[model samples]
Target: RSYPTTTDEEDPDSNLNATCPEYFRWIHEDLRPWAYTGITLDMVERAKATANFRLVVLNGTAYLEQYQKAFQTRDVFTLWGILQLLRKYPGKLPDLDLMFDCVDWPVIKSIDYGGPNATTPPPLFRYCKDNETLDIVFPDWSFWGWPEIRVKSWVPLLNDLMEGNQRMGWDEREPHAYWKGNPEVAETRQDLLKCNVSDQQDWGARVFAQDWKKESKAGYKTSNLADQCVHRFKIYVEGSAWSVSEKYILACDSVTLLVQPRYFDFFTRSLKPLQHYWPIKPNDKCRSIKHAVDWGNTHQQE
Candidate 1:
């Protein structure tokens, strides 16, 4: 929330020298081109301080200290991703200042269904929870779509799969509603599994329960992202809070049968109902899913 301005007396060249424009461009050029504005040595320091505070408060001082050490060594996954991008771009990295006036860090107010207290304080930045408050909004990190941080385990794989699906085209895909993920994360996932009986018995959806522990033992090769896209419909159910799988599900050419989500990610508000996805009511999940699957199956060409 603090917006401090750089003093005019400060040497512009010194500020420029302190910034790694190559690093900035590498991390943000493709995802956020506008991030290159107003970036300075001072801004970077401020952002770092804010980020460190957030980490310390939320993830404990040890985590914050670890990140600080990583930043110092330039050996963190986020920094590594930036370095890779810089290497990929080589001389093409831009010299623009992309740091923003305000930091857009994400904060979660509450994950439960009852909703957050009305008297809750303003979020430090964008907030995520079951419902949106004044300063609380933006979906969870699963849908944040920032690949540089390596925050979530599935992100890098999901990113590659989405890109691969884009290249493969939609004509080759089938018409079944497909969903694959661990069902143990939430009761909603268990409800989703209930709808996956027989085509005649329930929703004609194909739901596969993914045991991550077993999958990890098998090196995760069994779960193919491109293969999941073969279906024309994909179901997105929230696990505990808001599911990160929502982004991946929507990224596919397949229409997403989104179960009424309790939480929203940073980009969820931008998506319109019946436009980007078909909403399935949580109370009538089975019936709603069946209806959506039937509708999507009938209107495949649309």
Candidate 2:
């Protein structure tokens, strides 16, 4: 969806302000505390003038005209993704230059341990309010707000499964824990795969290796979200730093066996242990996961 060129007075129900009115209001009101503090009307105006693009801010709403021209060829996906997010809430999204960065292994490989950009940026958005110079303050795509293509497709199905799981009582699900994702990105995931039930130690976790390329070839219809929620417990192990799958895992009614994460997203820190999810040790992942699964299965009433 594209932003309207007409003024707010010219068209009260502009294309950007029409759909998701409540969502827009929530963004304007709720997200005000988290908005970039450095961005002023003068800065916005100067950015618009210098870039030779029209960015209209009317009634706390920002309308970027020729937004595509400001971005480079490499940033197309990031720009499109951010625009899709803005389109979701319309005029409610704040007027700021949202920076994007990859948080996976590729980004990690580029950084030197004791180098300049190493300790500070961390290849992901920093959550602190004091860091005003850093315009990269928005939450990752993993959280609820952003509208990426993969997220847009899977979230609905996941929500449906969540609703279905709620209807089908917790006791009905299988006694074992479940987790499925690609293990190539992080050694933590590889370690998780190794924790699967074997003669050495019974982890009581049904772990599956996800082949994205193979799944894409098969049209991704084989991996049903509802089928995944059939277990009494769900394990959440991060891929690289943070995985979008965390939210999906927590959405299920089953007990969430969360492995200690290296990085925390916008909302992850807010989640309480033994309440929202059962936390497992990062050091002894195999043993911790096995213990958590066993305890949860034994205390089904809890």
Instruction: List TM-score per model, in order.
Output: 0.57, 0.64
Query: What digit string (tens of lDDT, one per residue) describes model 2 on residues 1-302?
Result: 45633333543445864566322342343234335443444544433322323434454344545533422232333344455555555566554542233323123222333364543222222221121222223344333333322343345766777676876778888888889999998998898888788887787888989987887777677565666678888999888666767877888788899998765554565678999898988788777887887787788777
Q: Which stretch of 10 consecutive residues in model 1 shows the poorest summed lDDT?
A: 54-63
Which residue segments of model 2 deviate by more than 4 Å?
1-94, 102-139, 142-155
Top-scoring candidate (lDDT): 2
Instruction: Assess the local accuracy of residue 41 in candidate 1 as a C-alpha lDDT between 0 and 100.
Output: 49
What's the distance in Å from true for residue 4, model 1? 21
lDDT of 2: 0.59
The per-prediction tally of clashing pairs is: 11, 0
lDDT score for candidate 1 against the true structure:
0.54
